[model samples]
Target: MGAIGRFTISLRLLLALTQMAAVGLGGAVHAVTQLSRTDTTYTRVLEQEAAGMVLVTRAGLHAHNDSRLLQSLFVERDMPARQRILGERDRAQRRFRDAIARAQDVLPKETAALDDIERHFETMFDSGQRIEAALLAGEDERALRMLQEERLPAFESFRRVAQTEVARLHRRMDEISEEATRKAERAWQVTLLTAVLAVLLALFLAAWLLRRTVIAPLDAVAARMRALEAGDDRAPVPGQERADEIGRMARALESFRLAAIERRRLGHEARTDALTGLLNRRALLETLETLAGGATPLLAIAIDLDHFKQANDTHGHATGDALLRAVAQRIRAALRAGDIAGRLGGDEFVVILAGTDEAAEAVAHRLRDTLNGPVEIEGRLLRLGATLGIAALPRDAGTPAGLLEAADQALIRAKRIGRGGVGRAAARAG
Candidate 1:
């Protein structure tokens, strides 16, 4: 070809590349705008609407719980019982108020809804106080009538408003999800078109350019992101070494993954015992309190391993650990459905059963038999026996603390009486 022909061909290629660049830039700008909007909507839904909804729901539940506790006080004529219920009511109200305050902080735009929740909560709390006073004055009929007329209506109103707020939050979350989906689709379309143009332009250059540098890495990062969202944070993130925007994003996600893993580890360590993998004392007590506040029949069994220290002294710390683990396993195996077992430090363990005294006794017997396990150390056999103390809720005592106290007393009696005996707490005198 002539010099003029070569020059004209070069100019044509340059113009084509320039046009492709312009198109890609415009698509990039549009996609970025759509993604920004989607991100904002998603954050609002998660941080404000969804969090606020949960807090509101919790507040409503605690309010209803307080109402139930108050009603219990009306039936129990004993002063100590009244005081216990009163104390629980105060704790529930504190929790309810805390939840409401958190909801207000998150959903600051929902001021009117939050205000309604606060107003109704105050009304219900005040009515509860008045009814308590009526009961304290020995005016049983007046207390009952006031509870039915004043407190019940206020509680219903509080629940209604809370439910409405929850429903509104749900609707908002749904709308935001839909909007994000649409925006993401539009961005995907724009990106797809830009990719097609780049592919065509690459025909004049290297066809593999866009996929190798941009699309492939982005797809990998996005897949890893989806995995992270699905709660699988163990996978390594891609493209961290690249000195680009994608690299920055990948680095950020890796930090988040590491942080999540640390948080999970810390959470497990906090709740679980290091030796036996049973719930720790704090977690066990929290679980007990949650179950004890309800009307379900509960049984608290306190177990003390008989002659554990003797075995520990004879055999070594390793054999003692093995014995403890074997005993823990037996206790867990002996439990039925809905039963909770926890190590309360050293040779002390506790089991909370949501059943009758008969069921608890059967479990206690099974445990005493099962816990007599032999741990082999240096080809020798070492065994341990267990003693248990059983206490029933609302029969031995009403509250969680009282139940534990009764169970502990029974355990002390069991220890004094025999080597491996089961002792039951005496029924409460109403």
Candidate 2:
């Protein structure tokens, strides 16, 4: 009972633990998915900001080229070319500012570096304005000298600063990407560890449960079943020890086995004569009736111990019983293999010889000779004689009742003729 209780409790505990493990695995998978999504989002934002920063640096370099062209146009005194260069300068400046604004808005964390870039662009713009003023005042040489010393140097400084900032942003992006990769790797490692542990635990639990719930019980029941099939009803039943469904099945099998044994015992008793260990009257008649339909020829012989009643009256019933047992043994010894002999109450006996009736006369003579010679009971040596009547199947009679009637008639004839003589039935139509 204690073991049964533990089994029940252990089953529930295993189920609970399995559910918990599933929940933990699901949570770990969800965490990994969320981490991957977050990393992807951060990477996209960083890439967009980096692209915008590159656009701003390119625009600044274009504006510086436009400014240098504008000073050359002024020295050539080409009004149309100067006007186009000025317009290009304004468009480039506007494009540069717009790109910077977008980069700054997209990546607010890089504000300090953008501020320094903005400062360099402002210096370059101021230098360009001074060069344009010299051109408007017709100071060509002065403007050319200022272009080399002030505007050129200012534009170079702006370009250098923008490129430096762009490199810095790229380095920052690389750092962010590396950190995200490391984090993703760590999350995957944890998830894999948790999943592997859960699977191993589940396998162990399954194996344990199978052994307890199925394998052990089935093995025990199978052994008992094998014993039952082998006709060993006395084999010990182990299901009585178990408290599960297997135990109930074992109990049922045990009951069935006992019932089968009892049924066999009853059947044996019904067909057997308790006194001489031979077939009873009803069983002998049934055997003859069953043999009546078969194709093989069989002989039915009726036997009677001569003066049996006189012997019982003179020597007592105990002596008669001993005489009957001796006579039955002698009859059995005279019968060939496959011959069936039985007692038909009192001192009368019947024997059926299988295969043919060719040896019927010879067998009857043998039985008569066997019974005529023996008896030593209560220290008294008494000699006995037996009379036999032989009836051949399909020759003297066909039906069991006909055969028995004919054999009885023959026995009557033998008794009339003399004691201890063998008589054969008269022939009849098939």
Candidate 3:
């Protein structure tokens, strides 16, 4: 064979080897990034589940204190308080069990702690029953004795165990979060290192392969970048299909871009309600604080869905969730362009209207009318309504806390009078 033929064959062989390495590196980077994301997701689920457990247990403890108060009040023949206490306890028990059930899917490391919590809860309930039996029998003395001996010890034990488990879960979550951060940093480092190696390898082979051909492939990359700058939504960078070094580089860059976008999307999801697509409690507070100095006269309207719990019980949570979304849509429609609305968890929402009481009331009435209309969900029409409480900024109160308090008081008044009624807050003292 001639010298030119041998050179051509050797060049082709080298290019083939380089292409194989590039494909292998690209696959490795993708696999590593995906594994890191999956681990992070699992950690987040554990953290959220642990937090829920803590919340429910605390709520149960609060109800236990209220039941103790009712026990004392029962001695005074306060039948109303007795009934309320029983209802509160029942709700508390349900909440505790629900939290436990939800936590059952948590990571194996948390299993033992959760099991201990469940056992403690059972013990507390057993003692609670004996106390309730004495109360029902009208033997106030026996109830008091049982409460001091059995109920107190059981509650104390449960509280201690539950709180310890909560602390452990919190620590585990912190560790997981820190580990996830490290993994993210490590993934970036690995990807960068691999890209640098690929580029160095490509440069080594550039002499054997025609320099013109090697450089020509980069035109596609430059075009991709230009498309990205022009904000083209049609596949910003198509990499991985080309067998050249430029293809590998584009693939790596695309991965980084996608990772950044995912991070931003996760941040937004954290602050937004999944059901209503509204700002959640933490985000709402931040938004309110941001408006503290903007345009002197602002109004806050606290809204609660009337009979929402009953509706959830009757029509199921799916329907109730749909109702919440429908109400959010109506509220948003009623507000002016600049107004802000947020969900404060459950069936509660708050709206910040940039106007006077008169304007706020008008908006409130429109919202009420919109919410009271029939909602069509899952082939069934349901009637839902809202009770709105309006409080004006600087007029009702100057501070955020004061504004919220005033609005809440008005909401209580609206609910007290009747469902689907609008209430205005009393003027604040200067």
Candidate 4:
């Protein structure tokens, strides 16, 4: 062939080989990454299922107490523990099924291994059921024998299936790796031939193209990582407009940022009290360390409804809950925005008064006046009353635990003195 024609043919062949290598490497990377994620998810689901199965089996084996046995066996039983076990079993089954479905989607070609595992799982489940029945029928020896003979064997078979599946995954990974190596070798040979041709201009063009198309985006991603570490979100990403891999990555990062913000918002909402829109006890304690700086006074007030139990017993819990909500609103209205009010639980509530030394009597009067009005619930006029116990910051206690204890003691004294009254924390008798 003519020298020009030969050179032209060689260049075309080199380009074709390079493109094939890039495509193969991209596909291999994607497949391996996807397989790893699927395996991780599958492992988690399998572990959960195994743990739940063991728990259910234990519950069935120990169903000796007649009342408990009946409660455990009956799905509609009022026993919460039994119901929880059943719920776990159902959840485990659903997860296992979902894992199987996902494996089918991701690894459709590995059907034989998946089918083996599924068949073994079914056998194990059947054996477990038979063992439970035997135990419930008072056949202790038979149940024990079945556990050893049938259940254990079935479980071992399931384990073998798991091992087989893992082996299959490893084999597939090796095959993919070998295929990638072969592609790389072929690309390298083409690259060597191109180098021998000494076409400086073409070499420079190809190198620049590779850098812009591949290396530049990778460098940008690395810079983004450093920016993220520095808590900066303003880093520019390449290929934001192009519908390529880099563009997809930029879109993913944006999604991640939005999701992170939403998660933080949700976490804050969960820790805040719904009714009073104030930080709940858990959130208050979390921030108490920061609030309780050196020499900073942290006053704690424990508030209680004098006859809350009586109110619930008489007017029903619905009315009682409404009354509590009303009391919380009144307290929030009275306290400054800097102060924290929380419903600890039930009718008992607390307020963390930062840098306050108001007397117990004064605080009690303020709260009483705030909640003095009658609350109407379901056309019934309900009169509400509250008792307060005040413990001064840095004077009565230092730590959150100490402040809570002191306030609780003061609240007990207040209840003893009068139903709807206030008391200050006093020195405890040794």
Task: Give candidate 4's TM-score.
Answer: 0.49
- Candidate 1 vs candidate 3: the lDDT winner is 1
**In model 4, which range of ten residues has the least summed lDDT?**
59-68
Local distance difference test values of all predictions, in order: 0.75, 0.71, 0.66, 0.58
Residue-level lDDT of model 2, residues 259-344, one tens digit each, is 55754665675577666889876677788878776788778899999878888889987788898898888889999898899887
Q: Mind sharing the TM-score for model 1?
A: 0.51
Ranking by lDDT: 1, 2, 3, 4
lDDT of 1 at 307: 85
Per-prediction tally of clashes: 0, 0, 0, 0
lDDT of 2: 0.71
Work out the TM-score per prediction: 0.51, 0.50, 0.49, 0.49
Candidate 4, pairs of clashing residues:
none
lDDT of each residue in 120-175, candidate 4, tens digit only: 76686676677656655667678678877887777667766665565555555445
Kindly give the stretch of ten consecutive residues in candidate 3 with the minimal lDDT sum: 1-10
Candidate 1 segments exceeding 4 Å error = 1-216, 219-235, 238-244
**Model 3 quality (TM-score):** 0.49
Which candidate model has the greater lDDT, 2 or 4?
2
- Higher-lDDT candidate of 3 and 4: 3
Q: What is the lDDT of residue 177 in candidate 1?
A: 58
Name the runs in model 3 displaced over 4 angstroms.
1-235
After superposition, which runs of candidate 2 have C-alpha atoms over 4 Å from their true positions?
A: 1-202, 205-216, 219-238, 241-248
Better of 1 and 4 by TM-score: 1
Candidate 4 local distance difference test against the native: 0.58
